[model samples]
Target: MQKPKYKRVVLKLSGEALAGDQGYGISHEIINSIAKQVVEVVKLGVEVAIVVGGGNIWRGVAGSARGMDRATADYMGMLATVINALALQDALEKLGIETRVMSAIEMKEIAEPYIRRRAIRHLEKGRVVIFAAGTGNPYFSTDTAAALRSAEIEAEVILMAKKVDGVYDSDPLKNPNAKKFTDLEYIEVLNKGLGVMDSTATSLCMDNKIPIIVFDLTKNGNILRAVMGEEIGTYVGR
Candidate 1:
């Protein structure tokens, strides 16, 4: 059997990706499609861990702008991630994939509390682990959680699955002439404010020397393509 490019990876999914064209909440069809694509990569013997965002259901920053308490709003955002996590777990399990939902918060009835050793063990056993609750702290985005978990699990790379084709100099949807970058350095992302991920997440990954691949989640098989080391999206590193 051919070996995959990366032995272990963390797939960072935005809540908007789960919303598909609806623009709000979860889309069962879209989630199922993503799960199918993930199964393809899992079959390649890649250790898969996912960190999903909660922007679709709720955004903490948006809430704070509306005068909600900052910490309170962020905590609500964490719960939103748990909801997305459970939905993803359901989609993956229905496809016959052994999946686990590990929460940073203590929600024992629904998920396993985030334990570094337990999460690694789950990956070692070939079970897909979905990390929820965003590091169990307020003011931290799920992007940060993905970076944090990737470091903890020693994942080779972070697969940043986005709705856009890849990172563009400007919004591709808004700017017809926006330049697309095939690759970038982490400092460029920060200095240029490219918004590949938040500053903290980008900094964390940079400090840890973990490469990130930003690809379009709208396309089927992109996950597999990323895991196979194919040139699919913007590559960020060094």
Candidate 2:
């Protein structure tokens, strides 16, 4: 029995990761598998807060580029995150994992309004909290939201779960010679335009002195491995 490295963590799940092999929409198999992994982490006494993205359903940036109103498109993207949050909540609850869906947009019937105190309280009580709706505003990505919420809740680190195993100089799929980086500094990520996170999110993490671990979540038990400080991903810090 190894000790968990962090008592609390934020798990950032990109919308594409939830879509799995289908490339679009929530893949039940994948979501269920993710849910199981989350449950395993919870059983380890690690508090989990998740920030989900909505790229699989709709990308606001793409819509705006196509001539739609930027704010309107971004709001639509926020709605998509809520959908992902609810779907994930359902999956977790099926496995009897206590979960809460806090929406920034404040749909009283479907979710509770985002409250900093309440969210922390949920985590304190051992409940998994899923942040939805992308900060309730446009122009701010879920990546920023993850950083924002992690700072607000004082999470030890952010588990940036992606399809890729680790950070690379280029897209590993397209370039056989791409170099993998096991560790990176916050300044390097910003100056080099690394894909670890948006500048705003990266800055927030750096400011808050929060570390981030980017790894491939599709691989089973990677979350636990990360929690145990097994070094399965690229570590980013000051």
The model with the greatest lDDT is: 2
lDDT for each residue of candidate 2 in 62-135, tens digit (9 for 90 to 100): 99999999999999999999999999999999999999999999899999999999999999999999999988
lDDT of 1: 0.95
lDDT (Cα, tens digit) per residue for candidate 1, span 77-189: 99999999999999999989999999999989999999999999999999999999998999889999999999999999999999898899999999999999999999999
- Candidate 1's displacement at residue 178, Å, is 0.3
Off by over 4 Å in 2: none
RMSD in order of candidates = 0.7, 0.6
Q: Rate the local accuracy (lDDT) of all candidates.
A: 0.95, 0.95
User: For model 2, what is the alpha-carbon lDDT of residue 121?
Assistant: 98
